[model samples]
Target chain A: MIRFVLACLVACGMLGSVSVCHYMLTRSPVTEPPTSIQPTLRSESALQTPHRTPDQQADTTVSPSRIQLQNNDAARRFFLILTSGFNTAPDPFALGSDGLTEPTRLSAQYGDKSIITLLNDLLRGESIRSSEFDVADTDITRGTLTLFIRATPAETDARIPCPLRIDLIRADGFPCDTYTLWTPGNGVMLTGEATLNPVPGSNTAALGWELVK
Target chain B: MIFRNIYWIFWLHLLLNSMIPCSSARAEPLFTVVASTTQIADLAREIAGDRCRVISILGPGINPHGYMPVPNDGKTVASADLCLQNGLHLEGKNWMATLVRDNGNRPIITCSDGIIPLHLDYDGTVVDDPHAWFDPRNAAIYVNNILKGLIVMDPEGASQYTARASLYLNQLRVLDAWITEQFHQIPPEKRILVTSHDAFNYFAARFGLTVRSPVGWSTGAEIGGGMTPERRRHVVASIREGQVPAVFVETTVNPKIIEQIAQEAGVRIGGHLYSDAMGPAGSAGERYIGMMRENTLTIVEALSR
Candidate 1:
């Protein structure tokens, strides 16, 4: 009887040990919380939190400096080509002997410098290798200009040294001509209706254009 | 004794069974995303929620136009399952896009797609304006594109992404309406916006304002280097002719040229506007909506006089 009782006790102890072991092994393994459950890398509010700059605390007033201009020969040549028909005050809407309309004189004053520089760069045969914005022709007689402006790269933060192309077509001119100026490297093209207005008290004509949606 | 042996064997068998590990309850892997800028990253995160991990290559206060991808950025791109960019050459030569493309052939979502781009008339070329996010309506398109990309990458989270995106879209619509209301306070004639760069064209187009700046549409236009006599003279003349009440500087650009122009034109600096990039984290212009609001408020405060 003692032997049987001892055996039963031993069996019960063994069963208890086995049950605990089974629970431990079959139970899900302890894991660190999923990365998703961890605090987000950046919260909207956290992003909104200002990273203060030294200039932020300063007064709004800033000292002025002398305006200086760099004479880019390429820019000068491109401007000359762009404004070739400007001196003549030709009717921008009238078709020339050629198939295209007469080259309308545009105000050089309204030209963006970045566009000037980029045209200069491209016309000087600067190969942007990636996008073919090479100057095809500067033929003014035809009143038709063909340019291979490089396409803006699709990156959000890339500031390549290119120009944003802005094309202006006269709203009222018959067979309206399109003139383009672009910001350097930003692919923003601003297309508008360009009308030439005779500058008061001056022989030259100014571009009368407004942005179109 | 035989019964005892049987009991021992049974106990051993139970122990062996217990040692076998269960193969259930594995957590789903988190989708990894790499965005070119903070704005895109924020959009991805808002849409992705817990379903994805979004990282931005350009952090707070960094100018995307001048951003060069470091090697670590390449590593981040390598680990990403999807990439998002603003597209339209907003990345200043598409360096970020090129980096991602070089890293792998993963699907890249250009958020600027499907939005009617505002163009700048440069000579005779019409270039697409990269700053479409200036208008909240365009931002809605961005959210939609991001949502579509997320759904395509992780179809399992489609319902969640759709729900989150819908909520975000609602918020954007509210923002757009609020912007319209704010702009209404300023008189049409007084709605002239003079800034350091021509970044506010979209904002101007959306809210009926005129934008004049010494610099062209981009801050990368050779800050001091590109400042020609003609450009400087034109900007100053525009300010004087338009009677522009005030000129504003930009957060990402050097305000020196604009300050000079303002001083030369005898106009006070209205306020600094966030252009090209959003303000630093914790700034009034930190989020896209907040940035637009701050800009509108600054414009109204200066121009509404």
Candidate 2:
């Protein structure tokens, strides 16, 4: 009787172990590690290097193939092309003291550094010029760069010097004997020899930046 | 033995059933479209409905003229099946369009196609005025171009696209008539408009208003300097000369400049106008029609005196 009871207890123990092993074998293998472990691993890797924001990464990792116009010659040519395109009496609502407003001085709105960066990016490659750049119907080839200027009282005249010289002619392609001259920086000086044509249906004129060298 | 075999078959059937959903999920197809501006994306969505996925490169308040394309924008373009842009150089140096072309040479549709483009002649050079959609009739042309492009890309949905486009076009015609009637209330002499920039030339031409601004055709061109003394004197003189009852600010431009001019001229600041971009999602100018209506109402209220 004692031997039979012992045998029965051993058999039951073996069956329980076999059932547990079978269940374990049939269970699914985890495709992903536990969520708790992922954060710890990420933290460990993150500690190995400094974190970089997306913009910083973009600024640093600009592709080598991407063309940039960093030279003074390119910058000067770009400024001339940009300045030549302004319409005489461009803004209909705002008339100059002469009853015609030439293009607003660029140096007054943007800093030299900001303007240089924008021109460098836009005029980086030869193919870039074929692309049209327009704003509010005015075609421009550059991007916006924000920089601080000497702030003055709203009513007072804060005449910041213009960056480039521009010349304007009449719609009939005649010399209006009107021109604007200014020297912004980098030893760049414009003769204001360029002429502007009237944009049809608008009081403003259009500058052909593509025709500029 | 028979009972054990039956139990094994039942488990096998359960496992096979569980795999069906996973297979179907992987089989679903997606048609991806890339649009250059939010207005284009909205139009694409109206036409595509749930049949395709649409993404806009320029979001609300982003000036398409001065927009710079990043590396991620190129990646997005590479994954797109079709691309759309408001052509005639509306992309500000055509940067957005060029970026798309450079990425994959994917099929790009210019929504401004087939419209009689307004040209601006500066000196001897003639350039196309790209802001044609300010007029509802031009907006119809945009829809037609978009419809044709969609049909060419996905002929399977031609009938659906055609139906949606027809409905939208009818609504545009109605919107155009409504604009005409709204402007009729304002006297012809009172139709003089002064705003932040020259974006309203097409709008003014369509509605019979004389438009003026201190800034050039583009706000991007205003970069050389802030308000010059000459420009300020010019605008203030024009306002006084025209006896322009009010001056308006644009939603996309800085109002400070216009405000200063209005203050100097002693005229009330008219309500904000939407140019280059539409208003936020819940605003009155959210949709194309809504934007036109809001703009017309604002103009009439300010100038109707």
Candidate 3:
């Protein structure tokens, strides 16, 4: 009888202790749980400091549109940009400094790593560059051309009365014989459109864009 | 008698503690997933994301065309909480089905369920090619099915699986776009892909290229797949006519036939490509993405000349 009573008491104590321990363990809050992927949320300063490369600094600011240019030719080419509607001296709601208010700096997520920056005359802000970036060529035999506008979420002007014309001409100036790129009046702020054209006899195709309001 | 009862109680404590929810409870039934091939296994692992254990029957470079299952394979299949198979006759003699049916009939998820299969001539009979994963877009389908499978097996992990699947799907999308750009570098006439078997049909169709192979879809006889004299001669003529710069060999299939064809056509053997199986572990082609990337680079390097 004595042994039976002791055994029952011990069993009861064991069960109660286990239940409490389990409850505490499961109830405790985990400060940092184990996970395979931890999303890194870094600040702009960490990536866009002046010490960083020109590409890194340029990427911190948002922009209107970005175009990727690649060529197989030995000679380097430059983009010939024609402009009219930035409206430097327009009515109120005129763009800041450049008649382009709500300025932005955009970049493409994929493509070649080395970026081609705009010339000195096109840039204004020390870090936030101009919308008129350059389209330079390389000797590398990259066969595709890419154009990415800040489309999808919201449409900005470039934001008010955006630049009317931006064309990529191989020659020094607007050579009518050469094909060119276009910018619409709605501005480069929404849905992205891409088309591929086969270059006759050669592997490269000159990028052409259509102008729309 | 009293001391003996205390000893018994001590063991009971340890036993009950073991039953608590913790990592050491592995002896208990787990969310275990089984795959028939390494490619599907890799996809399952990516989608599972540490939530479950994934086991693959076929190791690196093991041909699924003529697999002979061992006794241990039965045990592995029996223990699975879920089974993943690359359906459409990817397994030889439908062995995976037999193993699962005999073992326990665990819920099987067909990874190729949603893909629009490409039909090819296997021993002169048109059959659905089981190499759809060669295209990253098709791989996204595999990922979705696995995502659904994992969620069904462990509903608690649905959010984690969905997040992982979303990220992985994005990676696959990027991979597809990257492949398109890579193929664009080659001229229209030069965009010919030569492999050991008819494994590149989906890859070629997705990226706007032409595939030339001397061997049938598989290298096994039971599957009605083998190189024929007429096919070899035709392939040689095609290579010569196009002045094809290079041909490729597969990691899983025998390289002898491809070597002979290369010699006859006087074209250099373009570096090896991973077809039926990925490269051995620790190699660049070990994972699915790495395998695709390596194959693309090999073709680009060899044919661009």
Q: For candidate 3 chain A, which ten residues in a row score worst on lDDT?
A: A90-99
For residues B160-191, what per-residue lDDT tens digits would candidate 3 score against the true structure?
Answer: 88888877765775576577668878988998
- Put down candidate 2 lDDT per residue, B38-151, tens digits, no spaces: 778877877776667888887776777678898889998888888999987778778777878799988899988766777765335576778888877677667777777788
Model 3 chain B lDDT-worst window of ten:
B21-30
Write the residue-wise lDDT of candidate 3 on A1-213 in tens digits. 777667667767877777787777677585897668886755433432222246533333312221222332312333323332332221111111111222223222113432222222222112221232233332112212344422111122333334323233343232211122233333222213221111111212222432221
Model 2 Cα interface RMS deviation (Å): 22.1
The window of 10 residues in a row where model 2 chain A has the poorest summed lDDT is A149-158
Candidate 1 per-residue lDDT over residues B53-164, each given as its tens digit: 8888887767787677889988898899999999888887798779888897667889888778888765456678888888766777788778878888989899899889
Query: Among these predicted structures, which one has the highest lDDT?
Result: 3
Say which docking band candidate 1 falls in. Answer: incorrect
Model 2 chain B lDDT-worst window of ten: B219-228
Q: Which portions of model 2 miss their true places by more than 4 Å?
A: A1-213, B1-29, B121-125, B222-231
Off by over 4 Å in 1: A1-213, B1-29, B221-225
Instruction: Sort the candidates on TM-score, descending order.
Output: 3, 1, 2
C-alpha DockQ of every model: 0.03, 0.01, 0.04
Query: lDDT of all the models against the reference?
Result: 0.60, 0.59, 0.65
